[model samples]
Target: MEPIGHQTGRLAAFDSLRSNVAGTLYEAGDPGYAELATPWNVAVRTSPAAVLEAATADDVVQAVRFAAANGLAVAVQATGHGIASDLDGALLVHTRQLAGCTVDPGGWARTGAGVTWKTVLAACADHGLAGLCGSSPGVSVAGYTSGGGIGPVARTFGAASDRVRSFDVVTGDGRLRHVTAKSEPDLFWGLRGGKSSLGIITTTEFSLLPLPYIYAGALFFGTDSVADVTAAWSQWCPTLPPEATTSLGLMQLPPMPGVPEPLAGKFTVAVRYVYTGNADDGARWLAPMRAAGAPLIDAVQTMPYSMIGLVHSDPEDAMPASEASCLLTDFSADAAETLVGAVGPETGSPQLLVEVRQFGGALSAEPEIASALCHRDAAFGLYSVGVAAPPELPAVADHAAGVQSAMNAWQFGASLPNFSAGGGAAGFAASYTPDVLARLSGLAAHYDPDSLFRLGQVPAR
Candidate 1:
């Protein structure tokens, strides 16, 4: 909500911003300020001087121009899945009112900044089309695609950024422009993964996949069989074809309303999978994982693409959370042992979830048009998340560090942008190589010479 007793900006400044835009503006203590300023992660706080609930792209341009003239920084939030702690003393652009999605039977779709994956999926289902979507269907398409989104069918369809057709964006210099591979080559490359570094995107269009339906879901087992299941997964992933995408998660679930009866208030391991190919081949390939250990719930089977969100079943409600992640060099036998010893059932771990996903299929290959997104050759991704209250944040942060340190031998020296949300410059350095970062900095200076696009993990030259 509103910061304790600290007021917002000066009345004159608020008046100036209000006069510049047609959308509604709320200062810190205003009626709608609290609702507009609150973010999804309660553990992370945002105290903006003012919030602009932009009604259209024209409002976005006006807000940018106002921030530039006032010498104030700017930050953007849609669904708030990726908001960081950099919103202080800045003007926030709220894009929730920019929602729309239209799918053409010609194999392409266009959406506004506020559209979510769930909306796109529903629209595409009527045409027997599938769009690349992340685990959580509620996150905005702009936020996910800006961070180089990885989805349930990532191995088969590749990253969401690779399929983007064009972007309508407003750079920090207060200019709205269209970005495409052939038109604005540098901005097109930088925006796909650089995210909030060069501009604020207003709309994005991308290609869609043909044919619906997929064989996907998760097999749940008690934590007692974690070691056995992990070992089997390590051996089985190498044998899988590009049509299959899979991950293994060690879960410590709290007894909540939506959690299943078998997994509530218990420790468990889930082997989640998705296959885009025919059902017969998918079942044949997934048989060994099902036989690895007797599952409490054998929920893996063929399902329509419209029901894809059932595969991961990510949390939809907002909660206080702290997360840490790294790319893995390998998932060897010793690596499995390291994972168990660090955050396993007997380790007295504090994290709610620890997961590792297999990579390297179409994900490793370059798209015909390349962007700044990197780490394509990374073998696997290791991520851990802890529930955090305001007072217990230090312990959660330290425990995540310890988990990352425990598997230092297997680290790939890079991280994924979507997962490394709050990590600032250090995480930015880890995600991109020296060359890409250098190019991003060069482009940032050329496009945003005033350095107004200063949010998120932008590389500093």
Candidate 2:
């Protein structure tokens, strides 16, 4: 079937979809179309042919079937944290109404596409269990895991995708199927890191970690100590073991409501740490860095796993943001010095945060059943984020690129799928190896022959 264009005929065809699905459907200029289609980044705009606030898995199936029969593309959004396309002339299945989360005390969880990490964290905490969630717990569990979620405790537990047991998904052909390693090996491997390429996941079930508390938080140092802290962190990271996960950030926070008095409207350095071992040993291991400089805020301590978001304190509200990232071969002292010279306190950088996260340990280990998440050997990951208002957008993008260029010496020339959002097709291609990308493309052809989800983060055949 030929793809539908933006015309009155396409709008009239959606009338059949509205009656078939048990959900609300909105067309362009509808009361809630703009609000439902908007994403959390607020930087990229999306205008789908229609939006379906899916009430159940059947709703997703109906939407996909409608798109297939009517010659329209298909896209899915939950929290919209990682939207990369404008989704023009597509049928957007918004899964916010698919809120179902059930945690089994036996150490596994089943969450609907709409459920966020915050909900899962709280539910699992009741049983002294924890799910591997990204820095911000506000993101959708299915969406984050679909991109091979790397989180605060990644070094200890590995990516969230590594723990997934199965997925209830609707493929491009509009058939609902249960996907697992044994049931459909190829789809199982691709869906974990391929995002929405092969199907729209309606539910995800994954194993959870035991224990409810850990030694985790961030230590903040003022501008005067930024150099010393960065150097110490660089030296200290190489000596750490698998039980510890950490990242160092060069922050230039604006004076705002959530900003602390000491850190607001100032340049500072943050040493974010999460140690899953004994509290004493975690503190002892952190002593060398603590002694590096006089910290303005020493907030590191033993905290409940449910409160994990405090380690990074990523903003929960929607705002315009420009983000860029790349993997690093190694973060040597020279690399650390170069980073400080570029985006540190003295550089007059416009970026709100430039961070380098240590990667390895369990994160580098291949799962028993492999996934499409590549770049496991990267030594570290570098990311930069800046507020992107209309006037400042150009400056933010340029400065972020300059930072990436400045660190080219240690760059590994690849990025994590979760961090490569909004980078377009080239960025998406960089997340995988040539062979892995080829495999995904082949699977896309087998599962979605019509390329219904091609407008998403999927690679072209």
Candidate 3:
């Protein structure tokens, strides 16, 4: 391969890459450069030296090879829901064109990097199979699973990463390899939760649960009952079986399109539940919380597995938002009280939503194959989100940090990779234990000798 021009000659040199790739390539100021470079999080401004909308797995290989040979770093994006960096001066490979979804009724599915969980969920629903998808089915499967996917049913099943069977990836050295537990154990272990620290996944194959339906939905409570409902939820979580998963969210929804009339322009609390067991038993188990206060909307009922996204009702559209999260060792009564006092209704909290999801149960079990995912032992996970334009961005960020500080007593000092994006290296390091971090760092050095992925969420050496 011929070496491209460097630095001052970089703009013209990208022409060579365009010729080598079957996909469309966009340089800075190119006609489609802005569109291809934009991420789902509108707040992050990505200005890559070039953008290659990868049309095939080979396009990824070419991008990697070109970047490696040209002394440019490479970054990968699917739906851009988890963009952690601006990707300035890098070679951005957009995989949106690699849309492919194939489901085997025999209890597994294979999807392209660009495929979202919505596609897989629809395909799997046909055969009474369910993929372990995150709260938002709109997120890319490869991207979510790559970060150790935790979802509404995570407590009943394990994380989506725990279900992964293999990945077709392009490593930093520009090699396309099929990675599985037996074929490439190290890569398999790292890729499951390392989130693009080692390579760019072209496709992913994973097991699917034989779940036709689940008794699940959200129970919304009025502001007057927020405290009682949250306190009940905190006390109720400990009694739930592994077959049941639950979370509570304190929401301050703005009156807007899609926002329900009862929940719009007011503070509310939502008790989200998903039970894989008998519907009758599920309802019986949820009785205590149901009696905590009169529900403004009781949408809980037996529903087809494809409708799982209703449990959380995460926004389907892209918007500018700030997020903060931490794991909790416990959510005792005192912790619950503290949380209510901090971000509950009438607390002057600026957050759009603050949630605490119950952990443990199947989620705490050791996966048959060990992966880089850690902090499974945490009892709960706390996350907060706020939508703000640039002017309000700083206040939103500061408020998010304040919410975390309010719950510091119960924090586990760690977090899940899926919820911890844009944290830079220190934030990435906080997600793993020292040994795990050291292992990931060492593997990154070996696989990415030139530190091509060093710019974003990957751990530092």
lDDT by residue for model 2 over 62-91, one digit each (tens)?
998888788788988999988868888788
In lDDT terms, how accurate is model 3? 0.89
Highest-scoring model, lDDT: 2
Q: Which runs of model 1 end up more than 4 angstroms from their true locations?
A: 1-9
Per-residue CA lDDT of candidate 3, range 424-458, in tens?
67777788888987888888888888778776456
Summarize candidate 1's per-residue lDDT along 1-461 as a digit string, tens digits: 22322444466666766787778998878999878888887778788878999888989999888877776778888888788664787889998888878899999998999888999989988888988999888888998998888888888989999989999999988889999999999899999988777788999999999958899999999878999998888889999999999999999999989999999988899999999999899999999999999898988888878778888898987888888889998898889888988888898898999999998899989989999889999989998888868788779879989999999999998998788776777876687888998888888888777667667556554
RMSD of 2: 1.3
Q: Work out the TM-score per prediction.
A: 0.97, 0.98, 0.97
**Model 3 clash number:** 0
For model 1, what is the C-alpha lDDT against the true structure?
0.86
Model 3 alpha-carbon miss at residue 224, Å: 0.6
lDDT of each: 0.86, 0.91, 0.89
Number of the candidate with higher lDDT, 2 or 3: 2
